[model samples]
Target: MAPPSFVSQEEFHAFHTIDRKLYTLLVINLWRDPVESMQVIALWLWLERVGFKNVVQKILSLPYILTNELADEAVTCLNVINNDQLASLTEGNDTPLMQSLIDRDLSLQFFDKHRLIATQGITRIVNEVCIRALRDIMQHAIERNAAQSLADSQKVISHSLQQPMVQPGLPQVGFGPDADVELPWTQESEVPPDDRTMFVTFSKGYPVHEWEVREFFTRAYGDGIESLHMQEVPPDEQSLFARIVFCSESAIEIILSGMSKAKFTINGKHVWARKFVPKRLKPSLPAAPPVNLPV
Candidate 1:
């Protein structure tokens, strides 16, 4: 059905009033809906820019920059600083990074001319901030520019029917279902038990509930993994999750595969079952070479 339109000024006013009221309610209630909260912050920011109070602008912008959804927007603001806005704001002469670097250089120059080294610290702090900003900008720019290249490179290549079947781990695997074939995991027992049990461990400090994990697995891998048991690590533990058991190899494969899809990792490294080695299996390595050697 077609929606009603607010064509008149009075109708528009009423709509705006309702929208603002709802947004205020959400904020007051501490709503966790990030997208909605971000939109409210954006609305407030716009209003502030159009001659609202400076204090209110500061307040609204703080949450906007700090909130997860709006953090990307904050990064966008940082990009503007790196690109030109902050420079233009600073008497149209210096950007934050540029000002830091130039200020340091000037301080160093002053010290050098006066035969003094006391200004070195001032130069060091300024130089570091400037360098950090420059590095950040470079990273942002490179990632920005690479988006197109990444998309282009992701295009699927046609493979001939006569080609031999390559293994899953190899680069020759096509970007299709064949690339996602489930690895084999079987028990040695001749007759498998009717009830299979899986072990699951979650990292400490994870906000998600145990039942959520089960639901996630159910949706991600239907009938693949069965009967998940969650054991919570200590609150002070570094890892958010760990120590899971699976009744069968199939269940383990399903769980691991789902984990990979969700980008869960150990220490920021992608872990696949085939690539994962137990600590016992990992060979002890020799100690590192001495940092200082005799000349």
Candidate 2:
């Protein structure tokens, strides 16, 4: 009705025709091959980075897709299923993910016992089917995203290797043929290094700021950095030294190795990276050569 308010009767009819066709196409595809069609949809949404909340909003946007009150009900149902209180009610026996089914009233006995879940309009059997459907859909979305990412990465590497030579100024720098090399196999006695912090010494009079250095590391490694800071450098150095701490020691090895091998430069000056080693205190003098009173 709102759509009719905004457009001519003929135009509204034409739009409705196309909308029905879209629904038919979706249903037909699902009916023909459910798994593959679901996967195709999952991949598309995953690639587009569409979140569950966005889907809800999008549905509410289209009057033909969902009415106002129905949309509210849908949102209410989602809140009910994703409730944190449901997980708490289960005690430590269930994780948030496992408690999702319980919250949806998949179990009849559990549903009857819990007033919160039973009050929902859907019956236990319906809830059970809906919960399973949600899990399958989510699982497909996650798997497709991971698989697509891996395949895309491999394709990029393959394309780079096939290229005749690196570009002149914008050289693709790394470990070259050994770029994909892995760390040596671990032994039983060996443990990962605890320190992931690195000292980055920018060249004297470097034109870049401390944030730029942090951004560079983030681009090379990843986000979720513990801390990044710029401290006064030695008088001879002139420029500042950046201390970047990572959440894990593996981040240090991987990021630094990637940087060292790549030899990346900014503002026409090379940035130097090294492990942050603490200076050891010198041993105390041998009791001042025994000149004082001997105990």
Best model number under TM-score? 2
- lDDT tens digits, residues 25-68, model 2? 23231221233333323321221232223332233233221122
Q: Which 10-residue window in model 1 sums to the lowest lDDT?
A: 274-283
* TM-score (all chains, Cα) for each model: 0.21, 0.28
Write model 1 residue lDDT over 1-295, tens digit each, in one string.
1114435444333434433333332332233233334333343333233333432223333222122222222333333423333333212211111112122222112222332222233234234322221223233333433553454444423234434678787786455755644445633543233223332322223344555655565565564443443334366532223223334556655554644212333333321122121111111222222222112
Candidate 2, residue 164: the lDDT equals 58
Worst ten in a row by lDDT for model 2: 285-294
Given candidate 1, what's the lDDT at residue 33? 32
TM-score for candidate 2, residues paired by index: 0.28
- lDDT, candidate 1, equals 0.33
Candidate 2 segments whose C-alpha is farther than 4 A from its true place: 1-194, 233-238, 258-262, 282-295
lDDT of 2 at 37: 32
Clashing pairs in 2: none
